[model samples]
Target: MQQIINFLIRNKTFITYLVLLFIALGLTFNAHSYHNTKFVNSANRITGGVYNTTDAISDYFHLKEYNEQLVKENRELRSKLFNTPASSTERAQLPPGDSLQERFKVYPATVIKNSYSKERNYLLVDRGSRDSVGQDMGVITSQGLVGIIENTSSGYATVQSILNTLSEINASVKNTNNFGSLRWDGNAPDVVQLVDILRAAPIKEGDTIITGGMSSIFPKGVPIGTIRDFTLDISENYYIINVALFNDMTTLDHVYIIENLDREEILNLENTTNEQ
Candidate 1:
């Protein structure tokens, strides 16, 4: 306390002069509109520079998520290169009957949080309302189908993982018309079971399974995985077939949000027919 007092006393003259100088400067700026504007601008520039530097430091912690997003974008580009035309102009020249829900745009996003070890596991994606994402949109990685969007915020979205209890996908045996419901029974880390397929259906041990396009979320030919095993249910009307998922749900990182263009139209049409 004594040191502070001595220091204040020693600097009293200089401190008084500084205080008077600040008062004079403040008065000058208040009297002149031009000086006031200049002062305000200069203060804003200094504070903005400091704020920008702080923001840059904070953003450094998000590098992993950003890199994952980059990988997803790269995969989308590759998918378009291999399958879809590079530009809309090129597609305009193609045959008229090529339109479908799969031809719609896919936005890339990173899976910040993923789960597959539980009975009703869900995944959290980093894209959300700000990126035009909404509930019920299909989310999938490059390897295979993943899940559907369940909820969204300004900067994030939660997906109902394929491993969830309520998750359902329309699938069929490759090269045959045997369609069934794909569900996870809370077992098998890398496998899901196909149910409701008739026992009479000729399902080989290694028969391929794929999205049936019965629902508009996935394209018809999008490759799922192959069958691993099978067993008859107690009623014997259907067979329980094991499916080895192409995309490992446990190790997922990046994914695409598929926006089915004709989904609403088809749904509305189906409702109209049901009401008849």
Candidate 2:
């Protein structure tokens, strides 16, 4: 305590000057409108900067949650779009007492494994038989089609990717009758080939391609991709088309699985006819 008193006595002159300086500055700020205004502005800017920095940090940490929410919302929208009737004409064509419920069901799944650089690339999703996922269900992302479900276990499923050489899907030109089988050449990851479209079909480099909806898998008009290039076959009767996919195969994350309620009925009827 005596040491403290000695130190305070030694610095008394300097301490008195520092206190007077602060008092004078405060008096000037309070007495002068311009000084007060400048001080308030400076304080506001500092506070605002702090708040902005804090907000940015909070948002960065919440990105994964935001992405999951967006995926869930997209799943709901896809279910509504596929389940709803396509047009007024189709709605009118419904049988007299038919309900307006959608024929296709949609479920969201996350990709647990993916392969793009192989002759037969496959994807594994987090949903399986326990989630009601089964073989032959079509999978897609928000941008475009992905693949079809191949095998399923209790908690996981394998998807036959569109990039696989053995993969074949029924596809067609948007807003036209020209249709073909979509296949991959096992060479390019972003491009696929379409075969069996007639030469006379009106197609161009940028024409849009979509699901033909002839099968029991995908509903009609699900976007596939845009035509990048095409050429007439040696026979000159059909065109071999090169399509640029919309989805980046190397960066797949969330996907939707589509279950066609009428698939079994349709397949059974076709098989019966074949036997006859």
Candidate 3:
């Protein structure tokens, strides 16, 4: 206490001057309208700047939550889209047993690990059996197809990336029955090969490619890529098309897993037929 008193007494002159200076400034600003307006404007600017900075920091921290919410909404929308019949006429023409609704289910997931350089590259996603993800489910992004779910654990699953050399998907040129097998040459990250498409399919450069709906895994019309170039094999019976992928396999993040509700039944019937 004595030390504080001594220090205050020693700085009394300076403290008095500082107090008077602040008082005088306040009086001057209050007495002059222009000064008062300028002071208020300056204070507002400082506070507004501070608030903006704080809001930006808060938004940055909430980005992950916002992304998850968006993914959920997208999953719902896609589920509806997949269930919708192509046309009301088509729906009426179909038998009640084959209602398009409830044919597929969509599950959203995040990529935890990705590989595109390896010959049999795979991606690990943050979804698994617990989330209803299963082996052979088709995975895709908003831009295009990713791959098929290969393995699963309680909380995670692996995707056999479409870039894998062993990957084979049924794909077709958009708006046509010209279908082919989509495979990777393990040579380029952005390009894959679509083999066995008949040369007379009226296809050209820049043609769009999509799933053929021939398998129970992926639905038809899901995007795969666009044709970049083509060449005839030695047999010249079919086209070897180079397709530029719409999705950058090297930068996968969020993905959706698609489950065909009738997959098991279809497979079982086919198995029984084959046995016969």
Candidate 4:
């Protein structure tokens, strides 16, 4: 206590000068409108700077939650795209109460594991059977297709990446009827091979490739990639196209799993017909 008193006494003159300086500054600010306005403006700037720094930190911490929300929103938007109405002529040919929504459903999933360096690369996603994700469902990202769901547990699933050697998807030239089988050569992660396209098809180097929708897997028009190059095969009957994938297989994160609601019925009917 005595040390504190001595310290205060020793600094009394400087302390008094500091107090008077503040009081004089306050009086000047109050007496002059310009000074008051300048002080208020300065104070506001300092407060705003502090608030901006704090808000930036807060937003940085919430980025993951924001990203998940964006993924969900994207899934909803894709669902709407799949359910959009057809042209007047197409709608007229449909049955009385049929809609596109009855055939397809989309759900969001996060990729927990990804491998693209291997020939048989597979991806693990956070969604599983519990989330309505099942075997043979198509998985895609906002940029392009990812893979097909192979196996599912209660809370997780495995995806056969488009880069896998065993993977095969029906794909076609965008805006045209030329269709082929999409496959990987087990060599390049960014490129896949599209075979069985007729030689006469009007294929260009930069032409876009999309899902064919011939099977019950992916919907029609889902973007796959662009044709990087093409050449005639050994037999020269078809063009083997090299497609540059839109999605970077090594950097996959958020994905959407698509389910064909009528897949079972379609498969059952086909099976019955085949029995005959």
Relative to the true structure, candidate 3 has a C-alpha RMSD (angstroms) of: 22.0
TM-score of 2: 0.68
Report the error of model 3 at residue 262, Å: 0.4
Candidate 4 lDDT, tens digit per residue, 1-276?
A: 999999999999999999999988886655343112223221123443454455456557767865885777679888876777867547646774476545788898777666899877767777777788888999998779998887666676778889887788999999999989999999989999999999999999999999997978999999999999999999999999999998877766668899998899889999999999
lDDT score, candidate 1:
0.76
Q: Output the better candidate (1/3) by lDDT.
A: 3
Q: In candidate 1, how many Å is residue 17 off?
A: 66
lDDT of candidate model 2 versus the reference: 0.82
- Number of clashing residue pairs, candidate 1: 0
User: Tens-digit lDDT track for model 3 on 11-55?
Assistant: 999999999999878876653431122232211234334544554
Clash count per candidate = 0, 0, 0, 0
- C-alpha lDDT of residue 16 in model 4: 96
Worst 10 residues of 4 by lDDT: 34-43
| lDDT against true structure, model 4 | 0.81
Residue-level lDDT tens digits of model 2 in 109-171? 877566899887777777778889998999998879999987675666778889987789999
lDDT of 3: 0.81
List, residue by residue over 1-276, the lDDT tens digit for candidate 1. 999999999999999999999987886665343112223221123443454455457557867865876688688877776786558657656775577423666898877666788776767676778889877788876677898887676666777777876778899998899999998888876889899999899988888898897987776766678999999999989999999988877767668898887878988999999999
Off by over 4 Å in 2: 1-100
What do the candidate models score in CA lDDT, each in turn? 0.76, 0.82, 0.81, 0.81
User: Predictions ranked by lDDT, top down?
Assistant: 2, 3, 4, 1
